[model samples]
Target: MERRTDRVMPPRYLASVNKVIVGLHRLGVPLPMQALTVPGRKSGVLRSTPVTPYEVDGRRYVVAGYAKSDWAKNARAAGRGELTRGRHRERVRLVALPVEERGRILREFPARVPRGVTMFLKAGTVANASPEAFAAAADRCAVFRIEPLD
Candidate 1:
C-alpha cells in the first residue's frame, strides 16, 4: 500500500467536483460520481458534496475518508440525506454501525470496494498498511449504510 504525501483532492478540485456531479446527474447519466445533500446541524441549511458510493452485497454505503468529517457528522445529526446519480435520486437515512460490527465490514472493506479505503490511504488516514490492516483501520473511519427513505 502506498500513502499519498499530499492531500487528497486539493481545494480547487473539490470545489469543482459538486458542479461536475450536478452536470452529470442532470444529463441522466449514471457514474461513480454522486452528490450527497444533508442539512447542516447548526445552520440548518442544506449542504451538498461530491462522493463516490460503494456497494457491498447489494447494500450501498459511503465511507468518510476522514472519519470525523463534516458531511459524516451532519448526516448523522440530520439522520437523513439525499444521494443523486444522474437523474436518479434517493432520500436515505443513515444507520451507523457499532464498532464491533464495523470491524467486520472494515476487515473486508478494502477488497470489497474500490474508492473509500484507498482514498483514505492517500489522505494519510492510514499509512501503508497491508490489505489485512484495513480492518483495524476501519475503527478510524466512519462507515454508514445508506437506507433509502420510503
Candidate 2:
C-alpha cells in the first residue's frame, strides 16, 4: 500500500473552516467535537483549530497528523483554553501525554472513529497512517484533557 504525506489545507479554506466550527459551537449543537486553541510558542498569539473528537469512556480526544501544527504548539504553551460544544462553553486545561499512553488510547481508534471516518483511516487512505506515524504526531501535538470548570 502507498502512503502519502498529509496535505496542508490552503490558508483561505482553513480560515473558512475555522469560522464554521466557531459558528457551530456557538449554536449549542451536540456533536462530537474539539477545539484546539494554542498560544503562539514564539509570538504568543492565540491559535485555535476545530476538530471532530473521538470519545472514549466519556472523554473527548483528537488524533492529529502533525504535532508541530500551530494549534498544537499553542496549547502546549498556554496549557489551557475554552472548549465550546454547541451552546455550552467551558474552560479546560491542556494535557500532553507520552507516546505509550497515547498509543493505548489510540489503539481503540478504529472503534472510536465515527463510521463515516473509517474510510479515511483505512489501509490506503490519507489517514492509512501507521501506528508510529500516529505516535509521532501525538508526541508533537498536545493531547488536551478538557475538564470542564463549571
Candidate 3:
C-alpha cells in the first residue's frame, strides 16, 4: 500500500487518491479530506478538488500550496463553493486575505502543518522554513479564509 502525498508523488497518483476520496465523501464516509466544488472561471462548469481545510482561530482556511492553482482560481471566480465531509456539505464563501495577513498565515504553516511545509518546500511554493522566508513567499500563494454561507 502506498500513501498519496504531495512530496515526490506523481500527479496521476494524487489525482487517483483524490478521486477515491471524493467518491467516499459522496458516500457519507467520514474522512479528513474536503471535496471542494466550485464553478470554473472559464468554462463555468463545476470543478472539484481535494484539499485539507485547516482551522486557525476558529476560522477555516485553505492554502493554495501550488499558488494560483486551478482550484484557487475557480474558487476566486465562483466566490462560493461546496465543502463536503462525509455526508455533510456546507456552502462556503472564500475571502482572500490581504498580502500582509497572508504572509502571517504562511509563516504559521511550517509550525502548524510541517508535512505541508515539506510538500510545499519541494514544490517550490515555500522557499524555506524560516519566518522571514515564509513571509516573503506569502505573496506568491493565495490564502483564503472560508466562511460558511448560511
Candidate 4:
C-alpha cells in the first residue's frame, strides 16, 4: 500500500458520510462511535466530531489518525471533552499519552475496532493494518486516554 507522507485530512467525501453516521447515532443506532466535543483552541466554540474509541485492558482511548487535525489539537489544548454515544453522555478528561505509552494502546486498534483500521490505512497513518504496524506508527499519531468524570 502507498503511504501518505503529507499531513492527512479527512477526505472531502467523508463530510457526507459523516452526516449519515451522525444521523444514525442520533436515532440511537448502536455504532461504536462517540461524538467528541471540545473547545476550539482559538475560537472557544465547541467543535464536534465522531470518533470510534477502543480499549486496552479496562481503559478506553481515542486516536487521531491525522495527527495534527483540528479536533486533536482542540482536545490537546482543551484537555477535556464530552463523549456522547446515543443517549449516553459523559464528561471526560483527555489525557495525551506519552509516545512510549501509546504503542500498546495503538496495537489493539486493528483487533479491537477493526473497522477503524481503514481510516488509518487510507490516511497512511500506519504502514499496514497489523498490530506491529500500528505500534510502530504510535509516534506518528496521537492517542488520548479517556477518563470519565462521573
RMSD of each: 3.6, 4.4, 5.7, 1.9
Give a tens-digit lDDT track for model 2, residues 77-112.
777777666666667776666665776555545556
Alpha-carbon lDDT of model 3: 0.75
- Candidate 3 residue-wise lDDT, 3-34, digit = tens: 22333222446667778888888788988668
Error of 1 at 84 (Å): 0.5
Q: What is the C-alpha lDDT profile of model 4 across 1-150, one tens digit per residue? A: 636466666667776877777777777776677788899999999877889887789999999887788889999999999988887888999999999999999999999889889888777787789999999887788999999888
Cα deviation of 5, candidate 4, in Å: 1.3
Candidate 4 clashes between residue pairs 3 or more apart in a chain or in different chains = none
Question: lDDT rank, highest first?
Answer: 4, 3, 1, 2
Q: How far is candidate 4 from the true structure (C-alpha RMSD, Å)?
A: 1.9
Instruction: For model 4, state the Cα shift of residue 117 in Å.
Output: 0.6
**Candidate 4 lowest-lDDT run of ten:** 1-10
For lDDT, candidate 1 versus 3, the one ahead is 3
Span of 10 residues, lowest total lDDT, candidate 1: 2-11
TM-score between model 4 and native: 0.89
Better of 2 and 4 by lDDT: 4
Error of 1 at 77 (Å): 0.3
Q: Runs in model 1 with CA error above 4 Å?
A: 1-19, 26-29
Superior by lDDT: candidate 2 or candidate 3: 3
User: Which regions in candidate 3 have their CA more than 4 angstroms from the true location?
Assistant: 1-12, 129-132
lDDT of 1 at 22: 68
